[model samples]
Target chain A: MKKYTYTDKKDTRSGFGAGILELGRTNPNVVALTADLAGSLKLEGFIKEFPDRFIQCGISEANMIGVSAGLTIGGKIPFATTFANFATGRVYDQIRQSVAYSGKNVKICASHAGLTLGEDGATHQILEDLGMMKMLPNMTVITPCDYNQTKAATIAIADYQGPVYLRFGRPVIPIFTPADQKFEIGKALMLNEGPDVSIFATGHLVWEAIQAGEKLAEEGIEAEIINIHTIKPLDEEAILTSVRKTRCAVSAEEHQLNGGLGDSIAQTLARNYPAPLEMIGVHDSFGESGTPAQLMQKYGLTADKIVEAAKRAMERRV
Target chain B: METQQLEQIAVQVRRDILRMVHAVNSGHPGGSLGCTDLFVALYFDVLRLKRDDQGKVIFDMDGRDEDLFFLSNGHISPVWYSVLARAGYFPVSELSTFRKIDSRLQGHPATAEHLPGIRIASGSLGQGLSAACGAALAKRLNGDDKHVYVLMGDGEQQEGQVWEAASFAPHHKLGNLTAIIDLNHQQIDGPTDLVMNNRDLGEKYRAFGWNVTDMKGNDLADVLRTLHESKNDSEVPTLILMHTEMGYGVDFMMGSHKWHGVAPNDEQLATALNQLPITISDLKDY
Candidate 1:
């Protein structure tokens, strides 16, 4: 197993904020609209520096989405920012009709995704966003692993036209990926190469997969770790390629097992490559009040959970 | 175009709407007929369109320097399609394809087919105003003085998104925008007043910091005057409360919510077309 270390720990939302600020300095058409989560989304620097480009949409997520769709008509790329719950479930129709259906160049940036939203409880933690966004035609759903990758993904989606749902998080996590990593939409990034089991993970769960790979090495288990940032245009080729060699798979994400990264990978495998699989995620349940660390353990989204799933998948291999 | 010419266009447009809905056995002929004159006024006279060297209307997705129109209440697409076709955005013959399979003339207006003149897709109500506000903001950012117009149903104001947009445009001072609410007082279920009392609609917008104006939407001259007067790049947005009939030309379909989304039958279509005159640019030629 390859050794990975991080000196800096930052919330994925900060990467979004940094990416927008950097893009603000570079791209003139980069406009930011927030539904009163400017501070939480870490958009202060972008707002302060490029005040003219920032639209304060108050608490109206629906209007924010509509406006973002509208902004694209005048050659402006709009990034509508809000919490994951408000960004997806609350303003779904607005996004469906205006952004996705209309094929508008709008970035639906969501922070505080999954149980890690913590303390705010299950209402704020959105587990169904990936499915909701992925199902919409002309929509690109990207949930990057860490701060650097999130930042790179944010900058990259600006270049790609059409609707995009960029899901990030609130809690600070280790920044393991390179600061200058070139983020490619719909392309899988291989974190580690092993022979026993292929572990496909997304968002915060990618780091857990990496940690699980280290643990599996101690028990003479070689685990292959693959990072799936783009969930909609699922890199089926990568999953097929890695799984064909490993012959078994374990999928992990900070989302529901029913519709998250696991379900997507499962469908891909069922269609193209049939293999033994174990999915690690919230099993048709809601979250509760707990710290980010406590929630991960309670919800089975930790390194140990990934290791367990990987072992289960390997045992089921035919 | 003169007021008389605009009136002729309105008659042809109403005829087009009837024929379109009649052919498909589906479409909203009532609101389409009701909004015919307003559509004629905007497409023919008021909207500052961009054209090619051949005098053809050039449809650009990024309608930066052109006056953009968004139909938020998209069920009335028949009227808009008729007007757009007659104004040379597309061929007037294509109006026959309304609600047909693989036609750019969708049941509701959409940009998915790369249709000329439509910049946004709208059928679900109360969304267009927010989009218009966004385009207006982008125009303001780009230093473009062109205006954006969006039309919504009276019943659509019942949507919370409408009020949110009403509050938004004013707060952002989107003077480059004008939102028109069809004051026909009818929706899908029943009268807007009966379904959801949008009590004092003008008063609500006024309190939301809009410069509200009333216009006779069925009258071409009045629609022209109001649209021209409302064109501004001010700090305040304008709201035109367009008073129109549910079905203006067709007497039987007039003033009833029942005709809102229903297409005109054979005899009904003949009777409705009889009420409107055939213009110089005949629909048959297309």
Candidate 2:
């Protein structure tokens, strides 16, 4: 087993900030809008560089969503940033009517996603965001793995036209993916290829999946790890191909079990090729005040939980 | 156009409204009749859009490229479709297809079905003003100073998001946008005052940092004058609280909430049409 190392542990939002700045320089149509979460969403650099393009929409998320939709009329690409909870569930109707249904090419950049946005409690931690956003038509949902990939995903969504929801996290995690890798929207990145069990992971859980794969390898269980960054257009080919070979599947994410990445994978496999599947996510409950690490452990969202789910799924793979 | 001509158009529009409502047997007629004159003034004079222009028209008055109108209170499709038809946005004969199957004139104005004139689908209320502000902002971004006009029902203002947008537009100095409230004082339930008292709408908009104005929405001359006044003031977003009577014409339904969502029967339609000056010589039963 190979050990992954990182020089520093920085929040994935820094990657978003860096990507936005790069986008500002590359594309003139790129504009940023924030709902009084400039510092939190890490859009300060882009705002500083392109103050004219950066629209401070104050605390009104609904108005901000509408304004973003309107900005598309003049052929401007707007990337609206806010917390995942406020961006999706809080302004669901606004986004549904204005952006999604209207088919506006606005990138809804969301930060502090899932239960990993710790200490905020259940009020701010939105585990149902994926379900709410993915339900809308013409919406592309992307949840990148780490700092480098988050940056790559942010930059990629700018060029991809139509409405996109780019979900990132608040905590710092492993940055294993290459810095210069081009982020494809629906393409799943296969980290480890094996045949016993397939582990599909997204967002902050990708690193955990890799760790679980390593542990399973030591136990003579060859677990394949695939990072499903795009949840909406769930890379069906990669998922089905992997599940067909492995015969068992386990999905891990720091989100609720309902309408999460696991649900998407299960639906895909059930339709194409039914396989034994286990989901490692928050089991129908709200998060409480704790650190990201503590919450992940308590809510059964860890590498060990993935290993356990994988073992259980493998046992059911007759 | 002269006031008489505008009045004549309003009568024709009222006739069309009754016919369409009667045809569907399920459409809002109260706000439709209340907003006919404002629609007439907008299509006839205020908005510099052309009927035959294939491409988007850029009105030169705003010094921006294009001027567009969005109907947020889309339940009043009869008035907008009638005005668009009368103003030649589409064929006047198309008025017959109002809300029928396979017709561009949907129950609400939807751009999804490629309805030539409409830009966005707005029937839920409290969404159009914000969308209008966005289009105005886009115009500003495109270096097109063209003005954007949106109409809303006074009762729709009760939605909290409307004020959220109302407050946002002014704070951002979106002066290119003009929102008109059809102060017909009636919603589905009853009077706006009884349902939810929106007392001092002008002051409320002013408090939200909008340049508020008042006008008789049914008076063509007043609608024109007030809309022109709204265009002149570019320092802040303007809100026209146009006071209008619910069910303006047609003596039987005038000043009442009964016609808010009910369609007219054959006798009622005939009675309503007779009140208008226009001769419906060829009233086709669909």
Candidate achieving the largest TM-score: 1
Per-model TM against the reference: 0.99, 0.94
What candidate 1 gets wrong by more than 4 Å, as runs, is none
Best by lDDT: 1
A1-318, model 1: which lDDT tens digit per residue?
Answer: 999999999999999999999999999999999999899999999989999999999999999999999899889999999999999999999999999889999999999999999999988999999989998999999999999999999999999988999999999999999999999999999989999999999999999999999999999998999999999899999999999999999999999988889999999999998999999999999999999999999989999998998989988999
Docking class of 1: high
- Candidate 2 off by > 4 Å: A1-5, B50-64, B90-97, B100-104, B277-285
Model 2 Cα lDDT, one tens digit per residue, A1-318: 445666766778889999999999999889899999999988888888899888888888988888888777777899999999999999998888778877788899999998889998999999999999889988999999999999999999999989999999899887888899999999999988888999999989999998998899889998889999999888999999998898999999888999999999989988999999999998999898899999999999999989999999999998
TM-score of chain B of each: 0.97, 0.92
- The candidate 2 chain A region of ten consecutive residues with least summed lDDT is A1-10
The global C-alpha lDDT for each of the candidates, from Candidate 1 onward, is: 0.92, 0.86
Clashing pairs in 2: B58-B65, B64-B145, B64-B146
What's the DockQ of model 2? 0.46
